[model samples]
Target: MDLESFLLGAVYYYGLFIGLSNFEFDWNTGRVFTSKRSTLYAIGTDSCISVLYIYYWTGNANIVDAIFGKANLLHEYIVVIMTGLRITTGLFTLIHRWYQRCKMMDLTAKVVRMYMARPQVKRMSRWGILIKFISGSVTDGLQMAIILNTMGRVEPQFFLGLGLQYWISVILNMAMVQQYMIMLFVRTQFQLLNSELRQVMEETKEVQLNRRHQGVFMTRCCSLADQLEDIARIQDELQTIVNQLEKVFAIRAAMIYGGYYLSSVGTSYLAYSILKHGYENMNMTLSTVILVFCWCFFYYLDGLLNLYGMLHVQDDYREMMQILGERTLFVGLDVRLDEAFENLNLQLIRNPLEIKVVELYDVTRRSTLAMIGNLITHSIFLIQYDMEHF
Candidate 1:
């Protein structure tokens, strides 16, 4: 096989490796959302292999017509075989991704419902939720566009490999977005809870003056404070994970894309240098072989780099999951209210002034609720409007 043909095949194998790797990771993480992207990547790589085969056959035909009397029968057969393989692979991958997308949509809806049902979260946070959803959707759309463009242009044998690069990029980006949003929500919820707790502490001072409820109230306040501290620590760890992911992505981008382009340019220059030296004995076939070999080597290297990057992204996500799991465990533990509120003063009052507290609470709750409602409604409306316009 010619250099180009060999390179194309190598890229196809590289894509196969990526697909298998992603499948394993997804299965381990229970993240079926990645399966569709992985399938598309495999298909794209397969397409690249087919395109390269066609190019190699065409090149061989031209060479035969120029020198020999007939085209090579083997080359023609290889081209037909590659074309069939490409079509089949592409079709299967497409179907798989489509199915996966539907499943992800359903899962996202369920997650949204669960989030909405959380009583501790303020309604105002809905605005942030909506923003995150919109941003995530936009990011996914951009990623699909990138994949289509890359896959549509790659040579046959190498088609899926190039597409796999974009697939990894899209997945990593989405994961980063999700982690960031989760961190944001965690912080917001902590703040809201803290504020409410402080207000409760202040209001209960008068109630404690005469009420038997002083001990319970004080215990609850201390327990809330402990929960807040635990959440804050988890948030810190999440931020660390986010930072690590960003750094990993930057290094991977440099190594994969930068290295590929640099190597391609260097190899092309080297080929040109050989030609410029007037090496008449070098022949076109030998030069073509060298060029094809170099291209294939570079394609394989790129795939390896992408795989490493993906592993790093997954590691960061796993760390975040660990932190969240730990936080949940801590939250589940019983608080020692007797010990926490032991030093607190509790006063009981016989006839405390009403001070129209109920009216005040009603007005404040109504205004806050209305504000939250407006914010959520406006964000949803804006998202809808943008979707229609786009």
Candidate 2:
């Protein structure tokens, strides 16, 4: 609906990747637009119905069978849902409560936006945009190829019926990528702040001194202190957003981790069964591979995003403030930048960004390694169980 003017599809798909929607939120009005909802509903209904009808009419096996330990189809649908959920919940936490996350980040982004207006930053940003675009396109192309290629055996009319679902999936995938990319870019912008502040200090140190210079130096230090105060506010807001997201992530972690465990372990079981049972069908094997790929792709992507956006930023931020405080300007602030920086540093240390899945486990590199270890162990157990019992 009015796709050209509004980025309607992208925004709506972006919404769904968090909770579910293909609509525009008017920040001013606080309303989600309904222009395309009817169309989306029609298509979604058709896709779901087509899958069911195809199962009955064409005798296609239940997709869930393959999901548990079989392989009737690839990740074409599952990734669309899982990754959408990952991004959906993420964006929800950010955008909910009146754009809480966006508003908080926007303060720092405002500063970085000025810095980014510099020629070098603009050029790098343009290139970064291009590379990200190309990389995402390539990834989708591969995913589409696998899905359509594997779907070739399906009846033509039935296959064609689900085209809109697939189209939306690609759009949603792109949106999901966009969300994480923006999240990462925001962190990078903050990092740029670190460099920018340090440069200002360096420049101040380089200037030669006179009586007038002392006056100028004090004025600049006062200005720096003011900026640090704003940054202190930013740190506070960012911590609030992180705390809320941690709770959201905690709920999400359970679903994602359980999904990975089931899909990974089940796909492995099915693959072994295929080889052992000698179901020489290429479709089965191809689907299994795609399923496994989906599990790994979203699972690891989720980890990396959290690692960089949440974990790394926590440490780097605290350290940045510490170093900034050690600067001569902050050391001599009449109002005491030291206390502000110290409080910010202590807050960050006390509440390092963390993502806990259902209060069960925190997402970290160590946890990731352990998850893999456990998955492998469980897969082995599944194999042994099948061999002994079946």
Using lDDT as the measure, the top candidate is 2
Query: Please, what are the lDDT tens digits per residue for candidate 1 over residues 223-263?
Result: 54565454444334434443333332332333333333333
Q: How close is candidate 2 to the true structure, as a TM-score?
A: 0.61
Model 2 weakest 10-residue run by lDDT: 1-10
Q: After superposition, which runs of candidate 2 have C-alpha atoms over 4 Å from their true positions?
A: 1-22, 25-139, 154-175, 200-214, 244-253, 267-311, 318-333, 346-351, 358-360
For each candidate in the order shown, give its overall lDDT on alpha carbons: 0.39, 0.50
lDDT for 27 in candidate 2 is 30
Total clashing pairs in model 1: 24
Reference-based lDDT, residue 346, model 2: 71
Question: What clash pairs does model 2 have?
Answer: 12-22, 12-23, 17-88, 18-88, 18-89, 66-70, 250-358
Per-residue lDDT for 1-390 in model 2, tens only? 332213323434545543333333443233433456643653464355335534544555433333223323332344344445543443333334233334423433443344334324333344444444445555556566655754664555445434433554454444344444444444555565577666655644543233256677667666656766666565555555455444533443464446556657665766676677544443445554665466446544543443455455555565676666655453334344445455656765676555565667775668778878998998788778768766
Q: Give the TM-scores of the predictions, in the order they appear.
A: 0.30, 0.61
